[model samples]
Target: MDPLFEFLLRQGDNTLVLGHRISEWCGKAPVLEEDIALANTALDLIGQTQMWLGYAAEVEGAGRTADDLAFLRDAWDFRNLLLLERPNGDFGHTMMRQFLFDAYQIQNLKALEASSDPRIAEIAVKSGKEATYHLDRSRDTVIALGDGTSESNARMQSALDALWPYAGEMFLADEIDQAMAADHIAPLPLEYRAPWEAAVLPALAAAALKVPQDDFAHQGGKTGRRHSEHLGHMLATMQVLQRSYPGATW
Candidate 1:
């Protein structure tokens, strides 16, 4: 596969899946303010996905558009990390999941902002700003819930443990990452590990939450080799209108 096209799908697919998961909370957030906030956050991710995937279509030159790449892809074709496809459990689980992904995203985007490719650089700069806000929001929620009460803390702790196993995959580099790094397209994923840990650990500390010491890192989605069953269910719902109507638009 074209490395740049594969890389773009990696970025866009993760954002698309996570954004759709978060959007599930639009009308069900614990409070109206948070409902509005989650909706806005989801919008940011969806917008970024569009830009990245739209660029991917251009690079492929196969007559596919962003909508095609998103709604038309099968579960096995999505290149999103496994963490993003996990079912959103409680609010605590959702926020912790968001925090971990956003932390990596902020660092990833910062590195990409220096890309030799002008298009990638521009998208990185635009997306990084939104990612920063997402990190802040998710971090705050983690701290609040982690320190709130026995029940809240237990739930938060459980979330951390469940999500920790998937954290390592973000830094797992393969041929796609190596090619991008060598071409000045983006930095190696492993290079962002230190900073991602720096951002994530302290927040966990402040929240009195402990990181699980799991060495088993579940991976494979980067190459579209594996995905959680949740993603299949999600895509079924997400692509419903598009699939049924076949390009119906407002």
Candidate 2:
């Protein structure tokens, strides 16, 4: 496989898996308005995933479609950071997860827009606009939850604690990422983190949310070494139809 193709699949799979997880909140959000908002964001993410994955499939020249790359893949095949697959515990938990991730994604996509690879750059350019909105919406929710009722505040804090470890993986560059950077296919992960943190901290402060004190950041999922427990059930639900009826499609 071409290295760029592998890079594209990694990006697509990350969004697809996370989008699928977030879509679970469509009907279950604590508030009706929030439910709609989350659903819309999930749709945006899935749409972006489809475009990237479709391009990735073409690059691979393997005759696999976007659906094949998404639903047909097993847990081990997914390369999303663990933070995304962490179970959506509560409204606050969901918001916290979204807050951290959306911030990173906005910066990441903006950087990718300038990628030397035209296809990658084009996808990033288009996706960055949607990602900007996602970050803003998620940021507002984080602020609201953090500054809301006592229970909401505590729940948001707990969510941050539980989800923060997984965030370390987002900025840890590996051989694949380095290759992409060297080839001007993507930006260095560290370049995006500072700006992401700058945007996140003020929001956290306004929400009265404290950053997790834990210095130890978890890593290694990119190599498929470790994953969240929720991934199994998620995979079962997502892959059931594909597994049951291989190549079945509408």
Candidate 3:
């Protein structure tokens, strides 16, 4: 696979999988405000996914549209971070996941604002606006919940502990990353580590959330070699409509 295409898939898959997960909370969030907010967040992520995957298709020149790539690909082909695929157990858990991913994304999109590829830079610019809002919203929620009460704080802490290890995957680089970096298309994922930590750690400290002591990073989500069971189940529901009715347009 072309490194650029793989890089695009990683970008799109992260949003697509996580977007579907957030959308699962529609009508199920604790309050009306939260319900609407979750839906809108999902929409933002999905919209970003369209741009990333759309560009990936053009780069491939393989006659696949964004929808085809999104709806037709199997789980093993996905290259999202494993953290996003983890279950959103409670409201606090959801926010922790969002904050972690958004911390990485905020700096990432900012970095991409200087990408050598003009298209990637433009997409990053547009997506960065939404990502800023996402980080702000999610970070506020994390702090509020983590400092709220015994129960809420406990849940937030638990979520942070469980998800922190997965956070390391964002920084571990491979050939695809090297290629992107070498071409000045994008920086190596490793380049974001300091900023991601700078962005994530303080928010977590403010939340009274304890960062997990164990830092065993689960690898292979981006490389698509070791995705968790969660992604397969997600794809089933997300792609079911298109899978069931191939070329069935409304």
Please give the range of 10 consecutive residues that has the lowest summed lDDT in model 2: 219-228
TM-score of each: 0.98, 0.96, 0.98
Q: Candidate order by lDDT, highest to lowest?
A: 1, 3, 2
Question: For residues 120-140, what per-residue lDDT tens digits would candidate 1 score against the true structure?
Answer: 999999999999899999999
* Candidate number achieving the greatest lDDT relative to the actual structure: 1
Candidate models: Cα lDDT each: 0.93, 0.84, 0.92
Evaluation by lDDT, superior candidate among 1 and 2: 1
Q: Model 3, 1-250: lDDT tens per residue?
A: 7999999999999999889999999998999998999999999999999999999999999999999999999998999999999988898889899999998998889989899999999999999999988889999999999989999999998888888888999888999999999999889888888888888888888998888888799998999999999888888988898889898888
- Separate clash counts for every candidate: 0, 0, 0
Candidate 3: stretches off by over 4 Å: none
Clashes of 2: 0
Q: After superposition, how far is residue 230 of candidate 3 from its true place, in Å?
A: 0.9
Q: Model 2 lDDT vs. the true structure?
A: 0.84
* Candidate 1 to truth, TM: 0.98
- Residues 77-114, candidate 2, lDDT per residue (tens digit)? 77778878888888788888888989998888888888
